[model samples]
Target: MFIFFGLFADPVSDVLLRISEAWPDLKVVRLEHPISAIAARFGENHYDLSRDKIPTDILLMTERLSSETPSARFLLLRTECFGGICDNRGRILLDGRTLFEAEGDGALRRLIKFWGADIGPEEIFEPLGRSFRWG
Candidate 1:
């Protein structure tokens, strides 16, 4: 399960789209403001966000998600900038542990590839000719 906070920049958004395409069953939730509009799911667990209040602290948010989806793995991505280093920098957390402190889109792509390797398809074959092979 992947939970995203804030608006995703173009590069990050593209990577996310690729990931979803590669792993069709992966659950992804983008949490946006007003807080009430976001609906999230992880594996068999589903959440209704209409009445829920989101925590401002990252740790607390992590805890909340962990509790909601106990057995599922989680990746939290957010766009955050500090100390005037706001060059599309983002933070990534894997299972409540900081995977990348402050990194750009390239780092995110690598992280996704690494974590998604086993779960996603080993090979993606594009169409070669008029006849396409399924499987």
Candidate 2:
């Protein structure tokens, strides 16, 4: 049970959706709020924490995905923009130092791939990929 916590970004949900699609047993949840539209599609778990702070035992959280990628972060934009995953407690699971570094490295590498920098995949993937983990 991973809790998607943050300012309620799209990428977060998008990635969780993908993970859920890949792993059905994985419980992806978010706070239920009026702002949430995915509640209809995914379930009624979508909510605004500020409005209703229902606490639950959370496992993990993913920080908000940035638009730093060349086009858009596949994990953040395409995936999160739809519906996000969250835990019953709402403790965000995506705020590890490694994950932050990985997002930065991945973003930079993605930009370099478009001729913005002269770095190698090893340099980029090492940090970015290092941040992500499977539970």
Candidate 3:
């Protein structure tokens, strides 16, 4: 029940499409708005923040994927790899340290791979190979 919001629609939709095609039983829900927005708009205290968290509590946000400036970071996740930075070439950094970098759609793929590790993509379908993953 990993809820996603911070990331853009490009990669998330791509993975969802593939997931739907392979595992029909796998449940993947895309909310029209973030939980915070929903709670604020509807005036309903549905989500209990103290007792329960938003699923896996993972949020990956990309500031500027393609840029030459040092200020252009690749990702900003909520947990695990939160605050991960990227160089002008999209190299990942954790806690001002280096983890790995991706070429072309590698950033998205690596995130997907991280997602798979948690959700067990291997148990459901064939490995999500890296190829034209970005659109």
Candidate 4:
């Protein structure tokens, strides 16, 4: 299965890579925020992040997309929540809930299982605890 972990410029990629390694079969796509930002900075390219955007008051092309493919997985592995990354386009893809708030292991595993998929051991650590383990 394909799992997307949207991340901004941060140490999130480090953690996500570790998790993806544990699950060899799962396809994990790491989308960088700078790439999206570049797309935003240069609009003609049509760098649609996920073909999902929701209109909001602050921006024109602003849009929101949910996990329509319950089976197709995605996770927000960034430092900030949904509102922090809301851009002029307003097309942010992710729920407002924090990764910790998503209940870590249980919620994540369930989401995978529900889709008849398997999950790797990608532990979500807080910013302060980021250096505990770098394996």
Candidate 5:
């Protein structure tokens, strides 16, 4: 995993958000927890743009993660193949895929081109194609 290889930063909030969106049928009581921020812990390097992902490493990781069940497999996709944004509306674009569950729930729109150096929202367009729609 990214942690064992020294890639440290907790995306707990993001993870919870994605989980809620992906499995909207389930209830997610995403309460806050008082943990130290990875930024505060690692500072500059935590958000470092220069940290490029090694192809072989990621492939190996993907292979390892894919060995799990569908639900678990989703985590692999979320971790490696997805880029999400909520737009100005309270909706989630799960890796630029369907987000019918969280309609009008959040209002923060963020454009993230990279989640490290390996993934982006634009990349999602390819796998899902134009067959998908926001509405």
Candidate 6:
């Protein structure tokens, strides 16, 4: 099972589709409002931080969830840009350990690789006009 904590730079539908294609039997849940989901899944006390704190609190949440549910995997994605500089970050956690972490275009590439997707980075970035920072 995979739980997505936030929106990714790529389209949600496309990302979900790719994941499903890679793991047909895998179940995925996307949570736009993670606080509510966490409360419902693990009780309110499991997440005490406010929405703005999510970015920094993700690891703690993932660790707790992993301890409680051995099969669960957490994917957290977030992007920030300033002064014409953009940073896209992605983290994958399973069994209380981070499986992958990357920034910028590498984040998307790692995600595709993690899912065993046959598609290349060009296939994904092409639609976005390759707007993602590449170095």
Report, for every candidate in turn, its global Cα lDDT versus the true structure: 0.33, 0.28, 0.27, 0.27, 0.25, 0.42
Q: Which of the numbered candidates is closest to the native, going by highest TM-score?
A: 6
Clash pairs (backbone) in predicted model 1:
none
What is the C-alpha lDDT profile of model 3 across 1-135, one tens digit per residue? 221112212233143454344334433444232111000010013224333222222212121221212322223222112233221112343333334544332344454343333223222211111221222
True-structure RMSD for candidate 2? 15.9
Instruction: Give one digit per residue, the lDDT tens place, for model 5 in 13-39.
Output: 454344334334433332122212111
Q: For every candidate structure, what is the RMSD over all alpha carbons to the true structure, in angstroms?
A: 14.9, 15.9, 17.8, 14.6, 16.3, 12.1
Once superposed on the true structure, which residue ranges of model 1 sit more than 4 Å away at CA?
1-59, 79-96, 99-102, 117-135
Q: State, as a TM-score between 0 and 1, how close model 3 is to the true structure.
A: 0.21
Better of 3 and 6 by lDDT: 6
Off by over 4 Å in 4: 1-63, 67-74, 77-101, 120-135
Per-residue lDDT of 106 in model 1: 47
What order do you get sorting by TM-score, best first?
Answer: 6, 1, 4, 3, 2, 5
**Model 6 lowest lDDT segment of ten:** 34-43
Model 5, stretches more than 4 Å misplaced?
A: 1-51, 75-135
The alpha-carbon lDDT assigned to residue 59 of candidate 3 equals: 16
TM-score of each: 0.31, 0.20, 0.21, 0.21, 0.19, 0.45
After superposing candidate 2 on the true structure, give the runs of residues whose Cα lies further than 4 Å from its correct spot: 1-13, 26-32, 37-88, 93-135
lDDT of 4 at 123: 25
lDDT of 6 at 110: 66
Off by over 4 Å in 3: 1-89, 105-107, 115-135
What C-alpha root-mean-square deviation, in Å, does candidate 6 show against the real structure? 12.1
Candidate 6 residue pairs in backbone clash: none
Q: Largest lDDT belongs to which candidate?
A: 6
